[model samples]
Target chain A: MKVANEQTTRDRIIETARQLFLTRGFAGTGIAAILKEAGVRSGSLYYFFKSKDELLVAVLDQYKGLLRPILIDPVEAATNDPIGRVFALLESYRGFLLETGCRMGCPIGNLALEISDTHDEARDRVRENFDAWCACVEGWLVDAGDRLPNDLDRAELARFVLTVMEGAQMQAKANKKIKAYEASITQLRHYFEMLESRAK
Target chain B: MKVANEQTTRDRIIETARQLFLTRGFAGTGIAAILKEAGVRSGSLYYFFKSKDELLVAVLDQYKGLLRPILIDPVEAATNDPIGRVFALLESYRGFLLETGCRMGCPIGNLALEISDTHDEARDRVRENFDAWCACVEGWLVDAGDRLPNDLDRAELARFVLTVMEGAQMQAKANKKIKAYEASITQLRHYFEMLESRAK
Candidate 1:
């Protein structure tokens, strides 16, 4: 019971920090801001996180944990057809973008832009998350098997898909248009169909 | 003579602010930091720009002004063939990326991530820059002439192309791999080819 209470406080701190980080960015957000927003008070925030950086790292981890399933689960479950799975994954992302009304950029991509050189640990985490994502994409391509080109490179394809998704989301948010995201998915789907036809 | 001196000082301040903002981001960088890095006195920094936010807006303007030619000039010159112009513009960006070692994210994209919602004027500049860029792309598509489908929506296609380019750049920078960017361009070229074929 006591552990649960402590965990709840920790979770609240993470939630508040994540929101602030997404809305204001890491540098703009401070420990005091997180503490005040979370209503945890300074001592409690320090008790859970040693510093603002540590809190930001914790918030990043929390985001990663939340996003992995949102991003990967659809692709993972659509194990039946690799190409279909890839499309489904993208479609799911499109749905999310539409629902959110295109507010925030990809949290992972945002961190990548914000912390590439200044923070080694953060950079590594961002890279690891991206690699894991690419691995899932690579797995889907492998499942596509005979349908994909005999020489189709899975890693390269995954990277391309990720790039489109990340970039499309940013564009959609910037322009406040769902069509931007849809356009990427449409082009990707067209490309997939072309690849499948070439296999025949 | 007074105006010239003032312009030089202002230009110096904006340039220094641009480099710092790109490297450290908005919140991580302060006016004091800008003055120190630019070797300009604090009084001079403030004499030209009213506040940190004002300086950030100027930095954003500088970013747009700098990127305009680097991104748009090639496309503008290759006017004879819209499709060709598109590829040439992208190729030029690749050269820039290679020259710089892909150290910084797209400046406008970076600022969009940092302050899109938080700063309205800054966001408007980002929007205008992107809109202008999209217009440049649309002009290329229009020039692609009958090679593109009569019914093919050029605006949508332009947005899609922008998404892929921006996303590819971000992914490439995040992983420090040129392959990511290369893959997107390759696919994009393929996409243009498909449009050409379908139009015919």
Candidate 2:
């Protein structure tokens, strides 16, 4: 029972910090804010996380764990066509922008740009998140098979998709509009059409 | 001469803040660090700018001012072909990544993601930077004219280019390698080729 309570406290702290960090950014968010928002004392926070940086690591780990269930699975289930799945994944992001009024972006991407230069462990975790994202898209491209050009490098294309997604989110957030996001995705869709047309 | 000296001090502070903010992020950098690095006192900093946020506006304005000479002119001078100029502009960013070992990304992009949620003034400035960048590329796409399909929406394609550049930089910085950057450019190049081949 004690262990269960401890686990709940840890999870609560991580979840609260995740939301705070996502909206406020790692450097912009402070420990006091997290403790206050999480409804925890300083002792409880330090008990679970030795420092705020440690808490960041926990949040990242939680993000990694949630990627499949929270992010990929829902989108993947919405579309069965391999190429369509690729785009459905992007649409999920567009949905996020709409829901947040273009205020929130990809949590990992937000941190990737903000903390990459300062935090090694957090940076590596960000990289892993990116790699995992790319790998999922790559699988779709590979499954796309001859519908995409036979010579098409699936891995590189996946990276491009990731780039488009991240870049689109940045523009959308900056302008506080979905137009930039829509425009980029439209261009990406055009590129994919060209690729498919050139298929073997 | 006294006025000129004051102008020099202001420039120095803005320049130092620019570099620090680029590498460290706006939220991550403090006024003390900027004052120490720029060799200016608090009195001088406060005299010129009321707060750190004000300093950030000045830094953003400095970036906006330098866009023509430092960013666009060199690339424009290097290429007469409109399409080549677009690639050349991307190449300049590649050079930055290589020189900085991928530690720094687009200063405007970093700020766009970091400050868009909290700082309205900073967010607007970042949006202006993106608009300015997109306008330059849109000009090139316009100049390319019939060489690209007439059906191509030049404005949207320009946005995609910005997306690719910002996204590429994010990936490069996260991975601390140029491979992701190179891969995205290559995909963008391939997309361009398809558009040109389908030219009117």
**DockQ in order:** 0.59, 0.93
The TM-scores, chain A only, for the candidates as listed are: 0.88, 0.96
Candidate 2 deviant stretches above 4 angstroms: A1-7, B1-7
* DockQ value of candidate 2: 0.93
Candidate 1 matches the true fold with a TM-score of 0.87
| Candidate 2 residue lDDT tens string, A1-200 | 37535669889999999999998889889899998998999998998788889899999998999989988899788888999998998998899899999998788999999889999999999999999999999999999988998888999999999999999999999999999999999999999998988884
- Proportion of native contacts in model 2? 0.95
By DockQ thresholds, what CAPRI class is model 1?
A: medium
Candidate 2 residues B1-200, lDDT tens each?
A: 37535668888999999999998888888889999999989999899898888889889988898898998999889888999999999999999999999998688998899889998998888888888888999999999999999989999999999999999999999999999999999999999999999884
How high is the CA lDDT of each candidate model?
0.77, 0.92
**Tens-digit lDDT track for model 1 on A73-126?**
756666677777777777887776677677765778877777766776777677
True-vs-predicted CA distance for residue A110, candidate 1, Å: 1.8
Error of 1 at A109 (Å): 1.4
